[model samples]
Target chain A: MIKTFLQHELKAFWRARNTGKNVAVKIIMGVFILYLLLCALSAGFFLDKILEHAFPGQNIVIAFCGIILIYFIFDLISRMQLQELPTLKVQPYLQLPVKRNALAGYLAATSIISTFNIIPFILFVPFIIKVIAVGSGAGVAWAFVGSVFGITIFNNYLALYIKRKANLNGWIFLIATGILVLICLGDFLWHIYSIKDISYLFFGHLISLPALVLLPFLLAVGMFYLNFLYLKDNLYLEELNSKKASHKSSTEYPFLNRFGTTGDLAANEIKLILRNKRPNSAIKMSVLFLFYGLIFYNKPAMMHTDYPVVFVGMFMTGIFIINYGQFMFSWQAAHFDGLLVNKIKFNDFLKAKYLLFTLVSTLAFILTIPYVYFGWRVLIIHFVMYLWNLGVNTTIILYFANRNSRRIDLSKGAAFNWEGVGGTQWLISLPLFITPILVYLPFSLLHYRDLGLAVLGAAGLVMILIRSTLINKLEADFYKRKYTIAEGFRNK
Target chain B: MITISNLKKIYNNVLVVNVPQLEIAKGESVGLVGNNGAGKTTLFRMILDLIRPESGEVISNGEAVAGHENWKNYTASYLDEGFLIDYLTPEEYFYFIGGLHQQTQAHVDDFLSTLTDFFNGEILKKGKYIRDLSKGNQSKVGIASCLLQKPELLMLDEPFANIDPSTQIRLKNMLKSINKQHGVTTLISSHDLSHITDVCDRILLMEKGRIIKDIATNSSTLAELEDYFAVGQSVISSLQIDEEENH
Candidate 1:
């Protein structure tokens, strides 16, 4: 039965009823794998740089390990594709004499079948290839191979776990933050015991290879178990297919009667995000800004003052906000018809989105509070960023996002060559990421920290100030192309 | 249940839809029949307030629907699976719509009990996400949702397009019963004349953005209505024969 199911999945992929772009993405990833392979082969020339420490060859293993770890991060980050897991749209097949276990097993196994991990095999294996062949048994080589497979499956499950957790509650993030806190504070606690660098003991040591071997295996098992549990829990029709975004309109919401009924609409949008996938992603995206400061936190001088590079870095990520905002209209694309038929006010509709933006960016602004402690100047810059994002990027993205044609499968993970991102998005990103650099670079060239900071600040402020006009421009632009955008999104 | 007046929706300087005064009274079942781009959907949407009329507005319950706050509380529609929020199972979706108007799940379950034959049994127990369901099954879920809501106004466009024939008949009967039982006003659009004829009281045949014929299907036989649409009248046909013989 398992074999039959596996064969079916393989056939299904070949004849998958997915878009051309999805197939094309698989091909594109193949190219990426090739490039990664070539990079590894080129790096093989420096194999002798290996044993600088007692664990001289450890760095290569670490490099290989890093590859595994980072891919896991990317997998989790790109939660859209793998997060909810591909719902078995073909579950009707369950009644067609197919064993339930077979169907479930097929899904569980297919989770590990991706081409993303091919690069590590090409890079890491060759480093140990000669060493294993000459001395250790092929069992060692087999372990390396086994470990790699384990990594792939483990990461797949980790991503799935995070996604499932995220779908359920906010505690996943709280837990993740808690974990990060523990990692950072571990050294401080270890120092109190005058202990060794913790990371070096388990991960860096060779004997710990068994744990590494078990890591991926355990994760894969855990994930399969999760998949099984999810299926078991949601096997009923009502539980499986219901849109879960429903919540009682809390009468106590102070803002409810302000916009009157539209206030409820605004309140629903908040619930839509909180109860839906986007808000979690939006929160994750917001927290990502805090991680940026962490990346620079380790730098001594960089923390003391606002560095142009970091400022550009901070402002460069302004595109993410735009990216988030791009789907402003499309998210509601499904209900566009309802919005029309019900005679709902378009102004209220637009106002609900704007209100939604205010709510999100405010959350993001609060999330970025940590930057203030980085420096007083960072505060001014991010504040300008907040306004600029509200004023400029919000309009810019809504305008172009109003133009983006692809239908975003909100249920799918938004990572790793996912669809709905288009050429228009690229154009939007260019100005958001680069334009800030142009403003910052000129000031940096003149050797003025405050001036460069001012340039960034002023640009954001100007965008905020002209927001109304810009929004008007976007509205006009949207009105012009609304039909085409609407039509394209529903299909894609 | 619904009315549209002087509705003109211009797109790129073109008069895409120009619907002039339409009144659908309480519990009336109306079918909007239009050829491709005859402005049937645009008219429905304008009435629904999904799109603004460049010139006019739609009124519901003697009030402009466009300005009302709780129009949706009593208005349940499924334009397509998009409105279905495919993540939810059929039962979940029904309960959600049911819940929205302050109905309980047991109420919805009781309402759904009448439509057991239509469900074809067992998929409802599968907890299948609406996205995972087949198009026909999805339509069943959608139709069941609108009916379960017991909305005073239900607008369903192309509801029968992708459904299987058996389910189509079930849906036709379901819509009929719902309209009769609740006095729910329904505006359904479909290219399938037969399905419309089976359910609708009045069929508004639209061509080139105007209602060219308002056939009282309840009063007239399907054959006569078909002939009226074909424009193959006795005189027009005889003239065509003479012209053909001359050619």
Candidate 2:
């Protein structure tokens, strides 16, 4: 029965797409898996070489363990955003007499085969072949592999447990990260309390080789057991029905209500964005970028050149426009059929998207104001880039909204995601970033910092003001191409 | 029960649903038939106030349905998956439909008891969500939901397209009882001509957004009905007048 279930699942998953989409996805994942493997091998080789200088006998195990822990953390964090159960295809199994524990086990085992798990094996296997297994004793090499595999299992299972159990906030990830950081900086923190020596006594001590292998295995087993229990207990009632999908109780967003009908519509659109994961994540991610400058900008000496701020600022704004704008139509993909069918006043709908785009990018622009707090010149250039991003980059993005064929997972969280992807999305960034630089770079170089700012700002303001003109032309154009957009959005 | 005036939808100077002013009275079962893209679904959506016509008014009991989104609570409609909430179990789906119609769980319970073999204890289980169900099971759930409500205006689009023969008979019987017992004004659309004839008091034949012929089941003989739809026109078929009257 289990074999039949698995067979049915594979057939359905493949059959959900056309041959082309399935082939393309398989090829992409294959290339990605290979790339990860190569990266892992190099890191392992480098780590082993470094530790060999300090503690030759225990070097391979120490290097391998360190690599395993960092990779485990990375995998666990990624897992939080992933659905343990695939959603689109899972609906067909509901009426069957399939047991919940069996379903849960399938999800758990699938979690182990992740790309993150594959990467470490790719990197370490070669290093073991070239260095550890060749040069180190048999017991030493065997112990090293055992401990690394155990740690990988530990990371994979812990992530599965937390992801399956928790309310799944991004902060849970930050808290996990903070604990690891404290561990790394344990000497400094321990010294803060005058226990630096004791910290060294425990941390610096040499534990038996067997203890390292034993610890991760124990943790992995414990987490897997906890996951099984969670499945057994909570496997009864299905999650909330789509009709009653919980949301922040509808609030009177009078802020957007001032645009009259447009405002009211825009306010409702904003409410939709706030209620959904992908759009809301856009807001969350942009706010998080505000701190990226502060995180790495702690050292004044490393800032010998102004490259860091400029790169960070450019990258930050670029990230927002690229990530948020890429899914321009997909955020509304589900309801576009209804919108097109209804007497929605089409212009208002487009206006609502523009309103949303401007609102979010403006919020991002405002958050980046502290970049000026670095220095007046850094501030001016950063402001110019931001204004350019709003004016030119955003408009270009909305224009490509016509052509963007990226499939957005409307169900996934917006913060740090993998939902929207396609070759077109990667290509969109070139124009969004380059156009702004071309317009402003020459003017700034000619001793016109303030002038460039005014021009960029005006251009953005003009785009916002004249959005109606473009949308009018676009509406006519889209009517002719409605069939194409519909086919593309549906991936038919 | 329903009245429509100048019901026309124009997209880029092309008429999509050029339904002239028509009235469907209370206690009538209507089968709205059309070929692919003949505007049957469009006309239904507009009548239900799901979409607006370019220039028309649809009134239910003198209340303009266009301004009322809550018309469906009284007039049950299942168009595509628009009505099905994927996350709910069949029981929950039944409960929701029942709730909107102001019916209690006991009403649903009593209804289910009549078809205990068909339901097979699935209704009592709250764990299984609707999305996990098969297409045939989902349709059964949907059909079961509408009947549970005991609606005044029951609208279903191709409700029997994928269901098993056994379940289909169960549905046909259930709908026949509700229509006769409550005098429910029903509008059902299907490609199946036989089923439509079995149930509908009035069957409309549509082509290219126009109702070419409207046949009253009481008036027309099955031979005459078959003759009207024959591939080529004959002398006698074209000669018939006052065609909507009794057999």
Candidate 3:
């Protein structure tokens, strides 16, 4: 049964519509995992030397024991972010003669087959064999290894169980983050408790009494059983699919309704961003990236440089344009046909896009007004970039948007998702990021930096003035390509 | 109001839709009937300018649909669930469509109140996004949005396939009344022969990417379609046997 299930998964990956791109992603991921394995292997091999240098006369084994609990704490947090919950299409099997318990057990067992469960073994087994087995005998070394493996299993299932619960009630995630923060504060800042001491107490005993390894082994078994039970009870289609009825009332920007159809279309676009998961998370990430200026501004090395400041300003103000506008047409892939056939004119549609971009970039510019404390120079650059983004970058993004036809599934998470991305996305970023620098580079190379700023601002103003012509061009281009775009979207 | 000349669409060198000449008069109610892979939807897409033809053009109201924006003002179509914005509530979607056509919210509500029976009390104010609705309900939302446009040319592909029996009957009546009273030109494609013949004055039977028969609907149209499909099934079964013996 397990073999057949694995075969199905392999076939699914191979037979995916984007198999070529998925293969490329898999290869890149493979190289990344290999790099991490190397880092952990080297760290494992040289631990004794590093600890010896840090702790002078103390035994490195005791130092390693003292930090094991802290390692697991951070490990649990990272696992929660990275590990995917094991899911099977249980609906099909439910109607067959298969047992529900067997299916649940398969799901529970597959959760163990992840990189998080293996990394700990590679990092710790070498140290245990090299240091503990030779010094404290082989039986005690076996007990230490067993405890580490058991704890890893415990963390794996615990993270999955909590994430599953978090999907049901979002506060579970907030509460989990809160408890982790408090633990860090208690040990590192408040000094109310020491995780190191607790780790030393427990692992220190495991060396003398090898039989105590059963404690974590039993905990591991208990977590596995708990996951099995959860899966068995919640194996129905509704629970597994998680199509929660959205509680958000449909938003209406009445102020936008006054702008006529363009305003109504822009209002609908806003709802598209807020209501869909992929776009919602994507906008949230862009909003969070507004703080990107803290890295470059006020730095003595970067204080005098104007080009990097321009780059930073462009990014902070126009990140939403580049991120969301890159797939503008594909965002409506589901209803592209309806849109094409509706009463809305193509020119008005383009105007709605421009309206949306201008509104968002203006808001971003106002938020960056505080950067004036960095100097008036930083504020001026941001204003120029805001105009450039609204006029120049938006047009460029929409020009390429006509060529994009890959359908994006809006229900998926934005992080690490590569859906609807194609060669056009990679190529479109070149002109958006580099054109401003190229426009500013020549004047800055000579000592006429202020002239370069004026030139960039003037270019934006010109694009804004001739915006009607640009829309006419875009509308013509869209007319030529709408058929191809609609056909590609329809294939999915 | 639609005229097609030398229209052709090919997928991997296989002609999917190839019509030398076809015309839909201003107030004609036409039913397109074909088996799966007969290119019913593909032909509708070309007329709506959703797909570009390889060889020719679709002219709507004396203007080519390929590059003209005027056809969209008068033509409304729903081909599949892809025609729906699945994230919006049905009412929100209706209002958005209504807003595009310059219909006020009150006018839209009045229009919807008349559709209470067609919606079967499941569509309005249900607080469910279109994606969460059943397939049958989603099609109802799509069809309702089309009627709201008050378009001169209305096109729907298999609108009755996923709808309930009672709603299907109601929709047939609605299509009939709209054509009779408002003189709206409607082109519906469905596999249901009885329903198609009942609703449409003319029927176009398609086979292998070409229209093989164009029959004016009469009392004998349903039996004619049934007999054609019945013979087609037997021919297909015999072909399968021949291939099996060859293998």
Candidate 4:
């Protein structure tokens, strides 16, 4: 039965309309995975020597044990973000004569084949062979390998269960991430307890006492059974169909009523982002990028750098404009004909898009105000970049948006679904990032970086003043290509 | 008033829609009848300026619809599910459309009160997004939204296709009352001969991208359409019988 189910999945993949593109993406992903495996293998092969150099006079095995916990912590976080739950496609199979246990087992077993589960083995197995097997007996080394595999499987099922729960209730996800962050803070900042010591105590002793391998093996089996029971109990179609009932509350943005039709349109766009899966993720990702400054601003080496701060400022302030605007018309591809035939003018439609971009970018700029901790100079650069984003990047995004004709499926998750992406998205990034750099390069080279910042700010201000002229041009460009866009959207 | 002169559309070297000349007068209810792939939808899209014709244009109220925006102010169309913003609740969608036509919330509420029978008590206040509604309910929402605009010219494609038998009758009566009361220029395309003939005074029968018959609906209009379709059906059945006999 499982083999038949797998065969049907294979056929579905082969028979999809975009098989050519799907295969190309798979090949690209395959190459990327292989490269990551190669890097991990090399790092594993040199782990002993590197540990010796980093922590001289300490036991290399103890140092290796110390870092293992950190690796798993990071692995858990990455898996939470990137893993996809395999649920939607199982609906049809539920009606068949196949047993629910068999289907649930297939789902749980298939998840273990992910790259996240294999990457650790590629990185750690070599160390077990070269360091542990050579130093300890072969029996202890094999037991150690068994324990690592057991723990990897345990983490896989645990993460999958948490992710599934998170899908049902968002608070689960928040609580899980919050717990992980607090644990890290306690270990790193407060000096309350050491994860390294705990990790060394657990894995370091497993070599001497091979019987301790039962601990992780028992954990893996326990989690597997829990997941199997959960899936078996919840395999009914009603359970899946009822998920949308929890999302029924409607919101009214009363303040948006003031802009009349334009405000109404912008409010509708906000609903599109919040109510759909793909756009919701895009908004969440833009919010996540708000903290991106912490990576560069806190680094002592990057404190005095002008170019890095400028780049970060532009990204932090204008991220939503770039992310959301690239698919402006395509976001409404489902209803492009309705929009074209309605009483709304093309100019007002474009103006609504401008208002949405400005509103979000301004909100993002205000959110980034905490960067003043670095200096007032950082705040000034961010403000200038914010202006540049509002005046310049918004237009660039909308201009390139008119060229994108591919329709995006709003219901699909944003992780790897490349439905609406095309050459135009790639081409738009050049002007979005590089134009400001070009304007600032000459002044920075001549030791007048402040002058360059002021010039960029002034240019952005000038564009804002003449935005109506630019909007008129964009509206004309949109009209010229509206039919082609409609035709392309209708093809799907 | 609407006029189509020398309108043409070709897809991959095949002519999809070609109307040399056509005209609709003010306050006239027009029903376009055609089989699958007969270009009813393509023509409707062109009239709405959603698709640009290869040559000539659609003129509405003496203004060319192509490369112009004035015609849209008085025009409303619902050709398919694409016309709906499925993420919104029905009331929100209606209010949004009403706001586009400068109608306030109270105005929309007043308009919706008239559609209670047409809605069949399943659409409004259901706490469901348009995407979650059944096909018949979705059609009701779409048709109701088009009417809320109080458009001078209204277009609907197969409004009775997904609706229930009861709602279909109710819709036919509602459309009749709207036409008589508001004198709104209306265009609809359908495969149901009796329904179209009963609601629309003028009927256009199209075959292979051309209007084969144009007749004013009277006592004999439905029978004439039934005979035409009966002949086409017999030809198809005969072809299938020949294939089966050969096998």
DockQ of every candidate structure: 0.13, 0.05, 0.49, 0.49
Query: Residue by residue across B154-235, what tens digits does model 4's lDDT show?
Result: 8999999989999999999988887889999889999998899999999999876788898999999999999999888767
lDDT, residue A45, candidate 2: 62
Off by over 4 Å in 1: A1-34, A44-47, A50-90, A131-170, A173-253, A256-265, A284-292, A304-323, A341-352, A408-431, A489-492, B1-202, B205-247
Give the per-residue lDDT digits (tens) of candidate 1, residues B1-247.
6777887987566677777888889998988876566677677666655555678878888788654646776887876666665554566556555655567668988988888898888347664656567787887787777777678988888899877788888889878987888788989999787889889988888765788788778645467667765663343432211110111
A464, model 2: CA deviation in Å? 4.4
Residue pairs clashing in model 3 are none
Model 4: lDDT of residue A367: 96
Deviation (Å) of B45 in candidate 2: 8.4
Give the candidate order by descending lDDT: 3, 4, 1, 2
Give the clash count for each candidate.
28, 9, 0, 0
DockQ-wise, the better of 1 and 4 is 4
lDDT of 2 by residue, A1-492 (tens): 558667876776676534466567568756865776777667766766766765567655544444445455555555544424322233345557777667666655665666656665665656656665676546555655665676677777776555443333545544664565465455343545323333223222223343455655677777777766765554442343233433223245557745544554566556555656556656565666666776546668856654455556665655667667777776655434434433245566667666666676667667777766667766665665566566566667767777654345443333223333333244446676566567667776887756766776678667657767877866665555554454354442
Q: Please tell me which predicted candidate would have the highest lDDT against the true structure.
A: 3
For all candidates in order, the CA lDDT equals 0.61, 0.60, 0.83, 0.82
Model 4 residue A426 lDDT score: 43
Best by TM-score: 4
Count clashing pairs, candidate 2.
9
